[model samples]
Target: MTKEFLLECERKLAKSYVCTALGRDDDSIAITKEIAKDIAFEVTNSIHPISMETAPYVVAALRTLANGIEKEMNPLDKEIARALQELMGRFQFVKEEVKVDL
Candidate 1:
């Protein structure tokens, strides 16, 4: 039952992400990317140092999505992309602290 619950949750989250990406405004898109970065940070922080399973998947997805987005972005969206990149850079600094402590 718990596994089913988790699967359903993931499905719903995927749909939400798709909708958010398709949103009409730059703010909405930026918000969506920001939310994704937060989720990635949480997943990375929660994992044990020895367990390399989830972080690679999360990072790969982010890089792939970001590349796809950058290729198609208009000027307004370029600003949003810049903001997300800055945010991700800040997050990377925190991630470094975690790595150093490990």
Candidate 2:
């Protein structure tokens, strides 16, 4: 689910990161597995402390970014914004049933 997005992000970053330094990783990242995955996990998170089991935070961070991108400057990226919006829209938050007496 969310993991797919993270992996995809890593792959994309790996290809694009021509020169950067992070932890043990440096220079051009030809190896697209561990180093890029580490970058994805560390960079995408916002609230939660960076860790391996931080997929929810990763998704949250991406959602926040996507939302801002869609709402900002009339959205230069119409197609990408639409795709992300549609995909995120499919999942609806569920509310718990509750009974109250006044």
Candidate 3:
């Protein structure tokens, strides 16, 4: 990815982080979807290196976000949480694959 694209992704993720931290469920969900889109773009285009080192931090943030919203979550939010969890699973799989390759 270009510097601009990465910066934009960082901005979106930051916004989502703040929204989640502040208990803005609707905004957090929207921003999380946007971040997911960014991930999709990175996956499809293969322009940027995926940082395995960041996986743990991302997973932790997602867990915290999910837990914070668990009480008020509707079906859609639950589905989104499932999707995020799946993404973390994929990250773990990739990390293991890399370790095996090494």
Candidate 4:
């Protein structure tokens, strides 16, 4: 089940983020897959709609998690952290737009 989730994340990231840079780095790919899985799990399990105001909080939390992961001194994980940061930025934008439309 977790493998399926990671695969879905990989497909989503490839289609949406076009993370071509991750192709050469297996560790980065794995880290990105894990991040995507976490995001997917949150999205699936949450009941409340994600608001623009809440997006930053979510990103901060993820950043904290990424920071902990970075302690391992893996450069590939840093790339994944950067990508996750970018994803949060984009999510914030979309959430802001949705909030305005509501």
Q: Considering every candidate listed, which one attains the maximal TM-score?
A: 3
lDDT of 3 at 59: 65
- CA shift at 73, candidate 4, in angstroms? 5.5
How much lDDT does each candidate structure score? 0.61, 0.52, 0.68, 0.60
lDDT, model 1: 0.61
Candidate 1's C-alpha runs over 4 A off are 1-50, 91-102
Across 1-52, the per-residue lDDT of candidate 2 in tens digits comes to 2687677666766654544444435334345344434444454343344344
lDDT, candidate 3, 1-102, per-residue tens:
588888888899899889889989899878876777676657544523335765576668756865887868899978876888676445422223122233
> How far out, in Å, is residue 80 in model 1?
2.8
Which TM-score value belongs to model 1?
Answer: 0.35
In candidate 1, position 98 carries an lDDT of 25
**Stretches > 4 Å off in candidate 3:** 47-102
lDDT of 1 by residue, 9-96 (tens): 4665576567666774565555456565655556555543533455687678768976897989899979966876676666543433
Query: Candidate 4 — which residues are off by over 4 angstroms?
Result: 11-64, 93-102
Q: How does residue 44 of candidate 3 score in lDDT?
A: 40
Clashing residue pairs, backbone N/CA/C < 3 A, model 4: none
Count: clashes, candidate 2: 0
- lDDT, candidate 3, equals 0.68
TM-score of model 4 (CA atoms)? 0.36
| TM-scores for the candidates | 0.35, 0.27, 0.42, 0.36
lDDT against true structure, model 2: 0.52
Task: Say which prediction, candidate 2 or candidate 3, comes out ahead on TM-score.
Answer: 3
